[model samples]
Target: MATGLHAPILDWYAENARDLPWRRPDAGPWAILVSEIMLQQTPVVRVLPVWDEWMRRWPTPAALAAEPPGEAVRHWGRLGYPRRALNLHACARAITAEHGGRVPSSYESLRALPGVGDYTAAAVASFAFGGSHAVLDTNVRRVLARAVRGEEYPPKATTTAERKLAESLLPPLDAPRWAVAVMELGALVCTARAPRCADCPVAAACAWRLAGRPAYQGPERRGQTYAGTDRQCRGRLLAVLREAHGAVPKAALDVVWDDAVQRERALDGLVADGLAEALPDDAYRLPA
Candidate 1:
């Protein structure tokens, strides 16, 4: 099954992969690492512009390390999770100070960087350095769940079984290409909501399709709601700080959200998260 699976998916990817800049030969390990960080929970379309701008502005780890953390957050620009910017900034500093301004090649070294978890570390190592590792991201998880396990969806959280399954399917040679091919297949064909089974290269051999495409029977999956939530309030407050050249008055932040209590709470949360700074004069700004 693993041997049969690799060829068609790699063939399909060769014919259909998107021409993202990060995939280019000249993109380097730094570009691939930056793209991996920015692509977290954000779609490729949104990440493209921000990535291009970031590459243009700070092409290397040392370049970004020299900038203030707040500058990273400011440039983050409505990416939804501003803390990732801080994480990337922290990673830049660490890479510069410890690794001599190079993105680490090994999964263990990459995983030690701030905000880089198991999936991210694996992705950077595999995609950037061509190190063979099981990169079980959401897309790959979904593909494995349906094609191998005959399940409509993977569990809400990764499991040991899932990890072992992913590891088992990894080819001995050209594993990095195989990894990205399966990921692209999941992203384009075996989607979570509406999988185009007809378009999937492995559909004929897919366990789920052979079993009549069973519905997801696991725990209910809930979509995140952002409206009027503390998260929304935090984004509103942070937007004001991101735009301000200097410390913004409390009144400036207060006007973005109507609920004074929620606004204040969100502001406090930002400061606590190192996304914002509070002045003695009651003004606020992005972390310096």
Candidate 2:
């Protein structure tokens, strides 16, 4: 079953694959690793320019490892979840210190690197090293759910069962291409809000289509609201700190948001998370 599915997907990908920078033949593993990290919560369009700039600045793990964590946070520039910056810095350090400035090919060694979770470790191993690992990303999950399980959407989160189901569908060889193919299918065809079912390569073989394309029955997960929320406040606070070369006066941060309570809470939360530091003069800046 996987073999039949593999051929069309691979063929389609050969002709129709997005000209992603990370997929370029000349792209290095470090470039692919950075792309994966930046793509975690950002769209491809948004990630492109940032990924390019990051690669230009720090093409190797050794370069990034030499920089301070605060520099990474500052360079992150408007990407939400600054903690990922901290983690990326840590990951670069580990890669440099332990892996001799190279990204590890083994999943276990990759996972042992700082900030590398199961998903990231698997993705890097499969995509960069051509290892056979089940790369169950959000897009892959949605694609598999609809194509194989006859579901409109994936489960709330990755589960052991989902991993097993996805693993069962992976091709025996060139598994990396298969993983990227399915993810691309999900991103371009089987989208969450508006899937272009008509243009899908595997539309005919899709279980959901055979079953009359039933919609998902699970509890509706609401999209996150960012306006006036803690996330927004966090972004504002981080932005100010990011722009400053040194400690920024608290008064400057206070101007970003009107609600004093929320602003203070956001600032304190940043400090608590080690993303920001509080100076004796009540100024804040990215951790030194």
Candidate 3:
């Protein structure tokens, strides 16, 4: 981070940061970890209520670990990647059996847990424990790209240089707060679309602003299509199972999607992904 930009960003964040449940002082490592995982691809508004209810229902790793994975998937709701819920359930059990039912503090330990990766580990270590780790999430990456690298967007995939950039940006002290402040600045001021540069704290030092903000020209950014796709089919099939208490007849699933090939493929995909189970009589339901 530019030395001049540091104070402005931290000061702006102090006044404008969202009062998300996960950011409260009372939220523990488990709550913060859950919020990070759930917030990965979902919007904040969608994640808030679900997180509150989830934390209420399973406050600790042991509480969630005591339940079947099916219960976790069911409770996951429409968070998009329901597989993350399964990973969380597996992670909870690992924490219970290995870390004495507590979220591990080290980046390595958190990364070793199911579905936990470098970004997730760094985020958990920094946000949950106030550790000095480079939290290079999408927002932080974008902020660095525009402000430091003079680019409209970060490289589609993270690079060694990106990690180095993030590490170099860490403040000498209160690195955790600095990391979060930059992340919030990106999320709020330097957004992907409609950035509020005039109000941005570091506008004067931003390389993008100095260079006259340019449009991304690397590759064609394509949006994902969901209608009539396998994902939509999966959602439809899962919706039935999520609402069901017992095995669902094959005929019931048949009505959800018209294309027999795509429907069966989606159902098979769900079972293959461990989001659902097939019974002996060809009926299906969420995994037991």
Count of clashing residue pairs in every prediction: 0, 0, 0
> Candidate 1: misplaced stretches above 4 Å?
none
lDDT of 3 at 173: 88
After TM-score superposition, the amount by which residue 205's alpha carbon in candidate 2 deviates from its true location, in angstroms, is 1.3
C-alpha lDDT of candidate 3 relative to the true structure: 0.90
How well does candidate 2 match the true structure in TM-score terms? 0.96
Compared with the true structure, model 1 gives a TM-score of 0.98
**Which numbered prediction scores highest in lDDT against the true structure?**
1
Candidate 2 residue-wise lDDT, 23-140, digit = tens: 9888888998888888886889988987888899999999999988899898888766779888888889988888899988999998887667888899999889989999988998
For model 3, residues 1-288, the per-residue Cα lDDT tens digits are: 467777899999999898888888999999999998998878999999889889999999999999989888898898888999999999999999999999999999999988888888998998898888999988999998999889899988899999998887788888888888988888888999999999898899999989999888777767888898999999999888888977999999999899999998898899999999999888988888
lDDT of 2: 0.87
Model 1: per-residue lDDT, tens digit, 1-288?
A: 467899899999999999999999998998998899899999999999999999999999999999999999999998879999999999999999999999989999999999999999999999888899999999999999998899999999999999998898889898899999989998889998999998888899999999999888988999889799999899888998999978999988888999998888889999999999989889988888
Worst 10 residues of 2 by lDDT: 1-10
Off by over 4 Å in 2: none
Displacement of the residue 225 alpha carbon in candidate 2, Å: 2.0
| Residue 9 displacement in candidate 3 (angstroms) | 0.8
TM-score winner between candidates 1 and 2: 1
